[model samples]
Target chain A: MKPRVGATLASTTDQTTVIVVRWGAEDLDVTCGGAPMVDARGPEAGTSHPADPAQQAGTVMGKRYASEEHGVELLCTKPGSGTLAIGGVPVPLKDAKPLPASD
Target chain B: MNITVLLDMAADGFGDRVVVGTREAGLTAQALRARASAGAALVEAEGADAILHLAVNTPAFPVALFAAGLAGVPLVPVNYRLGAEQLDHLVGNHPRALVVADERQRAAIERAGLTARTPEEFLQQTRTPAPHAVEPREVDPDSAAVVIYTSGTTSAPKGVVLTHANLVSYVLGTVEYGAAAEDDAALMSVPPYHIAAVSNALTNLYAGRRVIVLEAFTPQDWVETVRDQGVTNAMVVPTMLARIMDEPGLDRSVPSLRSLAYGGAAMPRRVVEQALREWPAVDFVNAYGLTETSSTITVLGPEDHRAGGERLSSAGRAVPGVEIQVRADDDTPLPAGTSGHVWVRGEQVSTAYAGGGSGSSLDADGWFHTRDRGRLDAEGYLFLEGRVDDTIIRGAENIAPAEIEDVLQRHPDVADAVVVGVPDEEWGQRIEAVVVPRRGVDLDAEALEALRATVRGSLRGAKTPDRIVAWAELPRTPTGKLVRRDVVAGLAR
Candidate 1:
C-alpha cells in the first residue's frame, strides 16, 4: 500500500468523506464534526489502526479524516450526507456526483 | 553543632589534595571547601528547614552536604528506586523537610503530592557575594549524622542510624588498612544514596584523595572514565565487575585502574580469578559489612588475593580496631572453625536505628550479632558460609546454599547461580539450584547432570543440590544484592 492519506472510505462509492489531521510527535488526535472520536480499533488497539468503523460511528457521528504530519498520525471522521463541515470548513464528497462509464 | 566547621578544619588539615570529581565538576580540598562555603551561605538565606535529597547518582551531592551544613538539619537521601507509595511513606514519616531533587525526579515527587526545589533554586537562595563560613561542630560520638534505609528483604525499609564518630571510625579503619593515600583517586559509580557510595566518598575525602563519581555504570563509560581520569581505585559489586569484564574493550581501556574493591555480595571464586587475570596489577579487596556498620569491617587484601583459592573463599580478617567472633544460637561464643552467627564490635558500629531506637542485634555487652553465619580459621580470617535464615534444613542436616552456589558459579558454562530450598514433605526443605548459563553456551539435561556429578565429586553428599534450574539472569536488588526470597517465590509461581 502507498499509505492512504485520509480516513478509510467506506465501499469506495459512499458520498461521505473522512479527513485526518496530523499533530506533533507521535500523538494522534482524531476528531469528527468538532467532537472527539475513538479510533476504529478495539480499545486495546494501537493508535494507527481504527478497526471498527461502526463502533466509532456510534461514538462520533460525522465525516472522518486521517493524516500523518511530523511523524504523528491522525484520523478524523465527519457526519451527514452531502457537505461535511470540520474545523470550520466544508468538504464535498466526490461520490456525491455520478461517475462516467468507461469502456 | 555545625558540619561546615568540621569540613573546613578537615580541609585545612589536608590541603592541596583532590577531594571530589564529577565528569563536569572537579575540585581539590581547597576548592571543595570554597564551594561548600558558598553553598552553605545559600542554604542559610533560603531558610530551609531540612534537606530532602533525592539525587541518587548525581554529581550534585556536594550541594546536599552544603545545604545540610548550613541548615543544621538532617540530610535525608531518599532512594529513587522506591515507588510513589514508598516515597509518600518517607515524606510523611519525615515532615517539614525541604526536598532537593534533579529534573528527572521532579515528576515523581509531584506525583507523590509533594513540592520540591531544584538545586538551582536552592543555590539562588543561598547565593552570596562573599560566602559566609561556619566552624565545624563538635559532634557527639553517638549523635546520629546520616540515616540510610536498608534494602528491605521482607518488610518496609528501615533507617539505619550512623553517627559521625561511627563514620569517622569506619573511614580511618578502611584507609589505614587499605593504604589509601592523598595521591589516590577513587571512582564511585554506585548511587550516592547507598551506604557504600557515601562511605567511600567520606573515606576518600578524609584521606584527601580525589573521588570521581559516575552518574551511572555503563561498561564503556566505566572503562573510559578509569582511563581518562587516571582512576586508581573503585568499589563495585561482583555482577558489575563481571559485566565490565564482559565488555569488549575493557582490558585495553582500563589500564590506568589500580585497585578494585568488591562488595555487596560474596565474590564468586571464578569471577575473582578472571578479575585477577584481566587486571593483574590492580589490588582487589573484598569488603564485608552492612548499612549498620557504615561500609566494611573486614577487608580481604591483595596479599590474600595473591594467596589464591583458599584465601579467596574467606571474607578476610577484621580490619584494625574491629573485633569479630562466632556465636551459637544461645549467644554462647563458638570456637574457631565453627559455623555460627557472626558478632562484631567496633567504633564503626551504629548506635541505634531510626524510629525504633536501638536494635536488638546489639546486646548490653556491646557486641552486635550480625545474622550471617560464618567460621574463623586458625589465622583469624572469617569465612562467611551464608545467612542463618537462608540455610536449608534437609533431612535434619543444615546445608548452606551459598556454599553450593559458589561451587556452581565456578563452572565454565555458568554465568551466575542462586540456590533455594523448596518445600518437601519428607526432608522439610529440598535443595534447588538456579543457574544462568554464559551467552551462546548450550546447556542441556546431560550437561547439567555432568555438572551435578562434578559437584557430587567435589562436595559431600548432603551439600549437593537436588535440582538444577537454568535461567537467563538472577533477580537482583537495585544495589545488586541477590534476591533469594524473590527467586524462591518465583519457583512457587
Candidate 2:
C-alpha cells in the first residue's frame, strides 16, 4: 500500500508557491515548472522525492515570482546588473543571471 | 530416535485425546497416523526429496511432521510472513524441497509458480502401507533438523541451523526450569515457526501436557482463553502481555493463569510490573535466546522479580548448563561489572548455519558471540543493555537504545516503545524513539516533553531520547520483534 503523505503548506502566491511535500516514497521527482528541484545523484536520492520542498517558483507576466508566500524566494536579473526580487521585500538576488527560454 | 518415535510416544501417552491440530480439526493418534500414511504416498508421487511446509497457524502441523517422519523425508517449515523475494530465494536455493501447503498458502506458491501439493491432496495420494520397511534416519546431533531464517533486522535473512539434539536439549532444559509436569496445560499464542513457540510445544510434549494452541492472539480472545481453559502456562511476547494487561476485563478473566513466560524481545519494567500486580499468582519468567540456540539460554525466574533488588534490571542468570560471558571488542573476556558483547555456550547451541552460511559467531573456543552488549553483576546475573548494532553515537558518547526504550515505556501514557539511532552529520547518530500510546490516551509534544523530563529525572542524561514520534502501532515481525531499523528508516525520510 502507498503511504499517506502528511504535509502542511507554508505559503502560496500567484507567482510562486512553497508547499511542504513530505516525501513518503523515496527518490521521487519533485518539480517546479517541469524542472527538477532536488538532487538525484547520491545514495540518499531515491526514485521519489524524500521530503517536502520548502521552496518552489516560476515566472509570471513580466515580473518574476521570485519570493512566494513562503519564506523561500527566487531571483531574476541581468549579468553584472545585480538581481531583482518581485515578492517578499525587494532585494539584490545573489549570483543572479538570466537566460533564454529552452526550445 | 526419529521424531515419529516421539510422536508415537505422545500418542501412546495421550491416547484418543488431541495430540496436535486446531480446535475445529484436531487429530487423535489414530487419525494422525492415518494422515501420515496418506501424506507419505503423496510425497512419493511428487518426485521431491523433501517437503517445505509453509503455514503460520495450522492445525495440520503435527500431521505434517508425522507424515514427513514416516516418509523418511525432511520437513522444513517456512515462515509464511516473508515476502515473495525471500520465498523465491529460499525455494530457488533449495531446489530439491517440495512445498506442502494448505489452501491459504496456495496463492503464494502459485505466485512463485513453484511445485507444491495441498495438505489434503498430499494425504490422499501418499496413502500407502505404514512404510515400516523404511527406517527413520538417525539424526546427527550436529546436523540440521530445521533451517529457520533469521529476521533480517540488520541485513538479509540467513538460515539458522537447528539440530534435533539442540532442540531436545533446549526443551528439556525449559521443562526442568519451568517445572512442567504431565498434568500441566499450556496456552500458546505465538506462531510455531518461531523458536520460542516450537520450544513451548516441545516442552509440553515432553511432559505429556495438554497444550491449547491459539491461532493468534486478540486482546479479548487471549483473556477469554486463559480464563476459560484454566490454562496453567502461556508463552507470550511483551506486546501480547501488555495488551492483555491493558484489557478491561483481564483482572478477573485470567485468574486461572499460573505461569507466563515471555521472550523474543525485552519487556518494559512497567509492563512487567503491571502484569505482576494484575496476576500475582502467575509466575513471570524472562527468557533470552535466539533461533541459533533452538530457544532459551538464559532464564530469569519469577524469584528474580524482586523490586529494588540486584536482579531487577538484569535479564537473569544463565539457566543450568548454559555459560555466559562478556567480551570486549578485541575478544578479550571482560571481568564482572564490565559491559561488552555477550557470549554464550550451551548444550542447546546449533553447530553452524544452513545453506553455505559462514561465520565464526561461534568461535573455535565454543563461545557464540551474541552481538548483545551487557554486563554481568557480581551475583552472576546478566543485564542486556542492547544490541551492539543498535548503539547510537551521540557526539562522542555511545548510547544503547534499550536504555531509552525502558525509560519511555515507564511513562504512564506510553503503552509500547522502540528506540533507534538515525544518521546525523553533527553527532554521527541521534537517538529517536517511536512510541505507541496506551489505548484511549491522547498525547502531544508537550506531554512527550514531560515524559522526556521523567526519563531524565529517573535515568539522567544517558537515557533521554532526542526526539519522540508517536505511532498507532509499531511495525513488528510475525514473531513480534519490533522492527527498529524499518521504523528508523521511515522516520529518517
Candidate 3:
C-alpha cells in the first residue's frame, strides 16, 4: 500500500510505531524488523510475524528514519526493537539541521 | 494528532532536560508531564471545560495549557491589558473555567463568581500530587485547543478558535522533532494571549529548546537579558527591535544570540535597515501571519534578509505546506504585482470562531480570505500593503477604530469622530483621531486633549487616540460611507 502522510503504522513483530511525515514516491513497501508493519487502527496492528534477528536493531522515539534514495521520512513516535526499512533496506537516521525559531 | 503527542514525545526523548524557565531550575520534560497529569486531576475534579490564563508569561502557563490538553479541555489565554468591563465580559464566556489570573485581574474573575488562582498558587497546587491522578485522555484533534479573543473591524471582540489539529499541523509542517541542541534557548517577549506565544511554546518545546519569558519590555533590559541568559534564539515585535537598534550608546553586543525574529506588525523600513547593520551576526527573520492562521504562514528567512534588497520590506514567501494567493473582491486570482486581498489555504489555517461567528470566512474552494491587501512578486515573495479591514494594529495589539469612535461620539461636546492609524517609527502605526466639534463650540488644542481624555475615560489606554485633531468635516462618499484612505491622506497632510 502507498503510505499516506500522517498514517500511523505499528510493527507486527515488535513494539515499534511510526508516523509517515513525508513521502515522495508513489508505491513503496515499508517494513520494520523484516516484517511488513500494519496500520495502527487495523486488527493486525501487532504480531503478524516474528521479527528477523538480523534486522532487529531497534528504533528510538522522536528520531526520524529517512531514506534519501527512496524519498521517504518516518518519525518514530514509539520506539522498539524493530528497525525501520524502506523496501527491505534499513533506512539511516539522518536529522535535518534546525531552522531558526520563527515563533 | 493531539498536542499532547508532542509533549509525550519530548518527555520520552529527553525527560531530564529543562525545557522551560531558567536552566538552573526549570521544569524538565518529565517533570512538566508529571505536573500536567497532576493538574489534569484538578481540572477533572472541578468539572471545568476550559482553562483561562489571565496572566503574563510564566512556567505555570505551559502547565495549564498541557493540563487542559490532558483533561480534554481548551486553554483560553485572554488579553489582560483590556479594561475591567472587557475582562469581565471575556471571563463570563467560560463560567466553568479554571482561571489562572494575576493578582490584579483576580477581582474581575472573582466578580464573575468564578474561582481564580494566581500563577504562583497554581504552580504550588500542581506541585503536589492529587489524590487520584487522571490519565491522559485521548483528545479529538478537531476540538478547540486554544480560544483567543481579538477585536477586529467590529467593536465586539470575537473568539478565534484554534483546534489541536491546526496547531499540530503547524508544528509538524514547520518543526523537526527534537531538533534543538541541548543548550539552545528561546526568549519570548510577546504576551501570553497572542497566537505566537502558544505556537512558540509548542514548537520550541517540540524542538527541545528551552523557553524563557520577558514579562516587561525595556530595550535595555531586553539586550542585557539575552547576554545574561545566554539566549540563542528570540522573538520580538517590530517596536522592540526598532528601540534596540535606535537606542544610542546601549550595550547591544550579544555573542550568544543567534536568531531574532520580528513580527506582529509592519516593520519600519528604517528599523530593518539599521538592525541589519547593528547585528550582522544575528539571523533576522520576518514572520507574518494572523491569529486565524496559527501564527507564521509566511517567513522572510535570514538568507533573503541580506541578499534581497527591495524584498526586505516584503513579508516574504509562504512556508511549506501552505499556499498563498492574491485575489480580487470577486474571488478571482490576481496577477503578480497587482495588490488585492490576500488569501491562504493550508492545514494550519482555522476559519472557525468559538460560536458560529459572523459568517463563514472560507469559500467553496477552501481558501480563507485573509482580509489583507498584498501583492505577490513573480518569485512568490509577498509584499503586504495593509489590512483590507480597517482594524488598526498598533505594535502587537489589534484595536478597532469603531470601538474608540463610539466612545468619542458619546461625549456631548463632540459632533463627529473618526479614529485612524498613522505610521510611526516606534509603533508600526499610532492611533490618530480627527474630530468635528459641536455647533458654535471652539475646537481648540484643549478640546483635542479633552477628546483624548474622553476616549481614555471610556476605553483602555491602548485604545485611546495618541493624537487628536479638530476638523470642520470628514471625507465621506455620497452614501455616507467613510473614505478611510482620504482620511489617512488628510492626516498625513
User: By DockQ, is 2 or 3 better?
Assistant: 3
lDDT of 3 by residue, B1-493 (tens): 5688789889988899999999998999999988888888889988999999999999999999899898989999988878888888889989999889999987889899997899999999999877887866756677888998764333367788888888987887788888899999999998888888999999999999999999877889898889888999999986577568756689989889999898887665656777888889989899998888999999998999988588887888888779998997688999998877899998788868887765655777779988777889999999886667787889998766755776676566665677888998998999999887766778789877977887788888999999998898777422123667778899999
Worst 10 residues of 2 chain B by lDDT: B172-181
Model 2 per-residue lDDT tens digits across residues B148-170:
77777777887777765566555
**Over all chains combined, what TM-score does candidate 3 have?**
0.78
What level of docking quality does candidate 1 show? incorrect
After superposition on all C-alphas, the RMSD of every candidate to the true structure, in Å, is 30.3, 29.7, 10.2
Give the Cα lDDT of each candidate: 0.66, 0.63, 0.83
All candidates in order of lDDT, best leading? 3, 1, 2
Clashes of each: 27, 13, 1
Which runs of model 3 end up more than 4 angstroms from their true locations? A1-9, A20-30, A36-49, A53-60, A63-74, A80-98, B151-155, B357-360, B391-493
Return the DockQ of model 2.
Answer: 0.00
Chain B TM-score for each model? 0.91, 0.89, 0.81
Best candidate, lDDT-wise? Answer: 3
First chain TM-score for all predictions: 0.27, 0.21, 0.87
